[model samples]
Target: MLATTPKPPYYAVIFTSIRTSYDKEYIETAKKMEHLASLQEGYLGHESAREEVGITVSYWKDLESIKHWKSQSDHLLAQQKGRDKWYAAFKTRICLVERDYGFEREEQT
Candidate 1:
């Protein structure tokens, strides 16, 4: 599902990764991180997908919120695990969303 984010001026953290192997814990940790992020002060929403590569884009109120999320304790441990065991490679990019638009068709009953 696509995330419904607030208007422009929001920040997005785009995390792209290639996994090492199917670690049973990866899914659980990912869920945990998403839940934790939702509870944070400036979190807006997120969307994610995984095929040959994994991508997660989380929206926030500002860069400060992104920074806080990065330094969060559990997230810190998860980051270490991703680096040491889960991810073969990963890249993160932060961008200010100046504008966005999309369309969703209504489902037929």
Candidate 2:
């Protein structure tokens, strides 16, 4: 499902990665990070997908929130694990969302 974000002028942290391999530890850590992120201040929402390459875009209210999330203790551990074992390579981009629009089909009963 797509993330339901607030009005524009927010921020998006786009994390794109190439995985070295998948493991139980990696899956668990990913889920933990997602949960931890949701509990943070200024966290709007996030959408993620993984195939040959993985992409996770998390929305934030401001850049400070993004910085806090990055320095979070557990998240710091996860980052090290990713570098040591999980990710072959990764790129993270932070963008200011100036404007946004989308459409979702209504479900019929």
TM-score of every model versus the real structure: 0.96, 0.97
| Per-candidate RMSD, Å | 1.0, 0.9
Per model, how many backbone clashes are there? 0, 0
Q: Clashing residue pairs, candidate 2?
A: none
Candidate 2 lDDT, 1-109, residue by residue in tens: 9999999999999999999965749888999999999999999999999999999999999999999999999999999999999998999999999999999999999
Which model scores highest in TM-score? 2
CA-lDDT, candidates in order:
0.94, 0.96
Q: Quote the RMSD, in angstroms, for model 2.
A: 0.9
Top candidate on lDDT is 2
Which tens-of-lDDT digit does each residue in 24-43 have in candidate 1? Answer: 69989999999999999899
